[model samples]
Target: MDKKKPKKVFVQGAIPPEKIANSIANHQSKTNIGAHSIFLGQIRADEIDGKIVTAIDYSAYEEMAEKVFHEIRESAFSKFDMTCCHIYHSLGKVKTGEICLFVFTSSAHRKVAIEACNYLVEEIKAKVPVFGKEIFEDRTHQWKVNK
Candidate 1:
């Protein structure tokens, strides 16, 4: 096993396309990994009940969110032989069809990369304190991931 330092976790106000692409590029340079898996989560304008979602407002308990994100990074390292990992999530309002979360993972083999990416994403969603509001086209709103 190589003594590789973990990548930083970015919980930001908004993340642009370049940042996501750059993160993947950054991780690629460090790993001799043959496989890299990336997951980008974008908002969708979907009708919930009768309201069509027009935008998303993301809010987080920042201190806890960062704490959880770091835990995820460490967990990913412990669970997989991954070469590197990067995670970024938006913190403010993101319009319809905009990306809100990005997860990148790389490994020496394809299987580990894929599994680690999925696991990391799932853990973040399940444990993180980030909240999102779904704003409808009619100007009404509802919280996302309310469950």
Candidate 2:
């Protein structure tokens, strides 16, 4: 992985399970990495005020969000002894039980991978300029707030 180059982080819709599997498989030849930590953020069927959420339509200022994602990756690399890191988030509608975000961190040790993965997830949620509209089963929608 090129540590200095910015990576593409956005996917058009829900992240595919095959992509996640391929990522892990591709890393098998990197003998130096002894551990990997992964985080998958799935949309939930949340109930609020008698309405049930069916999906989330995510949107973002792509250019700005990519910049922030690069900064977060750089920060993680500086703080953790990680060998590789990857982050992908959905750009369109993702239904309940579908993955909207995927974060993977690899390191020589389990703790570093785990900690870096956690850091990346938290930073992305707090710093990225992404927005989501929660779509209810009745077709009503409301802006989502990251909690």
Best by the lDDT measure: 2
- Model 2, runs deviating above 4 Å: 1-3
Cα lDDT listed for each candidate: 0.83, 0.96
The lDDT, on a scale of 0 to 1, for candidate 2 is 0.96
Runs with alpha carbons beyond 4 Å of true place in candidate 1:
1-14
Residues 1-147 of candidate 1 have per-residue lDDT tens digits of: 334454445555556888887876676566487999899988889889988998888998777788788888888899999887888888888888788889988889999999999999889989989889899998899888744
The positional error of residue 94 in candidate 1, measured at the CA in angstroms, is 0.5
lDDT of 1 at 112: 97
Tell me the tens digit of each residue's lDDT in model 2 across 43-97: 9999999999999999999999999999999999999999999999999999999
**Prediction-by-prediction clash tally:** 0, 0
Candidate 1: give the clashing pairs. Answer: none
Candidate 2 has a TM-score of: 0.97
